[model samples]
Target: MNLKNKIVIITGAGSGIGAATAKLFGTHGAVVVASDINLNNAQKIAGDITEAGGIASAIKTDVTQYQEVEALIANTIEKHDRLDVIVNNAGIGGKEQLKTAEHTHDDWHNVIAVNQTGVFYCMKVALQHMMRQGHGNIVNVASLAGLKASGHNLSYSASKFAVVGMTKSAALEYARKNIRINAVCPGFTHSALLDQLLAVSPDMGEKLKRFIPMGRFGEADEIAEAICWLASENSKFITGQTITLDGGTSL
Candidate 1:
């Protein structure tokens, strides 16, 4: 599906899945607004997109902060005049050293603040604009752990699970208003952060792969493709659902 002229905003566009999605969308002819907590990283991605002859801009935003998120959306609209799509992808893996029972309140709140609450905050403000225009699409980047138990990574899993829950509710709420909302569940995608996680336990990586019938870790591009499809007219009939790019690991 073509998204020529569409105005899209992608959080966490500095790296990983978000970065991949922004480039793909820009190449597909969408005007992408890349937002990330890291200004340098966001600017680099925007530069790459521009060099490739795509329309893009970088916005440094801390998704967890309401004021920052509000300003991010406001600035996008001020620049483009309208917003057609929003991908809430900014997130973290949460405190690594802490188990469920050992997690500090600060760590737990921090993960939820960014991963779950941030998605909701974005949707709330995005829909305000979308509802005004009477058309829009939203895609939340959740994780496979949202669908099932992901022992040891309690806060991240919990936040993602909340994202899935919120997406379903929001999707139904806006469907009649001519807006579609969905969630993407990706499994063990390779990212710059993967090496650090894998170092914790080499066996965990192997264990994750074995769960996937494809016998390999998925890539960020793989997940980005699904995000694009859901955002485009190709999947107009789909809503209140999640597209899993887990390589059959969820099977």
Candidate 2:
């Protein structure tokens, strides 16, 4: 899959899957716009790409705010004259894990605002531009939790499931317009988010690893490869589907 000269925007590009993806796309000849809530980290990744002779720019953005998302798209157009691809990868887990009945209002609302509503903001603006241009691609970073229920991650699961539904619904509407929309559901990936959770319960990682048929957690680059394919011309006919990158754990 070739992404040469593609103007790509990746949110949560500071670390983990997003960072890995930004680098991969850069190497594939994309002009990457890396956005994250943390300006410092975003700049770091962008700098890394630049040092490696890749084109990139960093923008500090909070996806929950519609205006920021609007500006993110606008800025990309201002810089590149077109928006070619977007990876809605910014997401958060509950501040504290909670059961369905125990979820706090703050935790539930925050998770949905970032994971669900954030995707909506990016897609809405991107579709408007893509419709006018008559071509574009959007890839959302959902989770395996979105596909199946997991205890104590209620807020996150709810937001991701909404993303799954939204991906399909949007794909169907825009397929004829040449705008392909899809989602990636990553399972037990070794990311900063996973490390933070593992730090709290060290043995949990090993316990979770046992469930995967491959007996391993996915690497960030592995997930990045899938995102790149979904955003590339190679997936010209693929849309409205959730590509699960689990190590056969769901089966």
Which residue pairs collide in model 1, if any? none
Output the number of the TM-score-best candidate. 2
lDDT of 1 by residue, 124-146 (tens): 99999999988999999999989
Question: Model 2 — TM-score against the truth?
Answer: 0.98
Estimate the TM-score of every prediction: 0.97, 0.98
* 139-207: candidate 2 lDDT, tens digit per residue: 999999999987888889989999999999999999899899999999999997688668768699888
lDDT (0-100) at residue 247 of candidate 2?
99
Q: In model 1, what is the error at residue 134, expressed in angstroms?
A: 1.0
Cα deviation of 174 in candidate 2 (Å)? 0.3
Q: Give the range where candidate 2 is weakest over 10 consecutive residues by summed lDDT.
A: 193-202
lDDT computed for candidate 1: 0.91
> In model 2, what are the clashing residue pairs, if there are any?
none
